[model samples]
Target: MSTYQDADAWVAMADRTRRSIVERLAHRPMAVGELAADLPVSRPAVSQHLKVLKRAGLVCDRAEGTRRVYQLEPAGLAAMRDELDRFWLRALDGFKELVEDEGDPP
Candidate 1:
């Protein structure tokens, strides 16, 4: 298990290419070759993205023969999602209060 600061998770996912790779893995585990086939980047670029995701704790890998397969590290992603949800909840509550305050005195 690894701990990722909330802000960094957002940043790691900020890039469109990285997000696309992550989203595809969210569906199922895939070998690097398969990932490259589906992506616009070359295999080496995909490898580099995997390295970033690995360090961020958002992804993990295993070896099956010569292939290295990658998948979402659910535990890390769950933590990230929880943090995002909490942020949204707080923002929404503030929005609700602001909207209410703009109306006649409560």
Candidate 2:
């Protein structure tokens, strides 16, 4: 939609720890500690990364007892994918227009 501040914010969220967290939770929800156990980051670090992901709208969480379980948010990912798709499509269309406007190729 419109424009994001920069693709970097979302791309940065795609880093190793974040991706691992997202992948782990994509199938099922998990607590931060559980995810931290599987990752190299400390629990707090995992929580911090989760905060970033959540801020970017890439992940969502729900209260389960006293803990918060995190899961991937399909709508956010879809929005990001749509933006990327539109960007590439427009780029390709421009390339095509340029080539066509050049007359016959040498």
Candidate 3:
């Protein structure tokens, strides 16, 4: 039960590494070491990225036998999706109006 801000989720995903992390987590929850091994970065770098993701509410972690496994936060992602949907709707509405008005005499 976490409160996620759509803006933070958008900003957090702006980084390539963070986006990659999210992609990995989308498939399965993983430990920091596992992610680091797959990525081109070090374990410490992965940990730092996880910290940012956690703060942005894009990911959450749980301790399991001395390891913290990270997974994607659906709630945060849903918020982001809603925001993007709204943006696209507004853009399309404006475009529709502009196209319709083109046939009118200025």
- On lDDT, the candidate that comes out on top is 3
lDDT of 2 by residue, 72-91 (tens): 87877787888889989999
lDDT on C-alpha atoms for all candidate structures: 0.85, 0.83, 0.89
lDDT of 3 by residue, 26-82 (tens): 999999999999999999999999998888888999999999999998988887887
RMSD each, Å: 2.1, 2.8, 2.3
**Candidate 3 residue runs with Cα over 4 Å from true position:** 1-4
How well does candidate 2 match the true structure in TM-score terms? 0.77
Backbone atom clashes (below 3 Å) for every candidate: 0, 0, 0
Model 2 global lDDT (CA atoms, 0 to 1): 0.83
Alpha-carbon runs more than 4 Å astray in model 2 = 1-11, 98-106
Clashing pairs in 1: none
Candidate 1 lDDT tens digits, 1-106: 3344555667778888889999999889999889999999999999988888877778999999988999998877887888879889999999999998899675
Q: What is the TM-score of each candidate against the true structure?
A: 0.86, 0.77, 0.89
Cα error, candidate 2, residue 89 (Å): 0.8
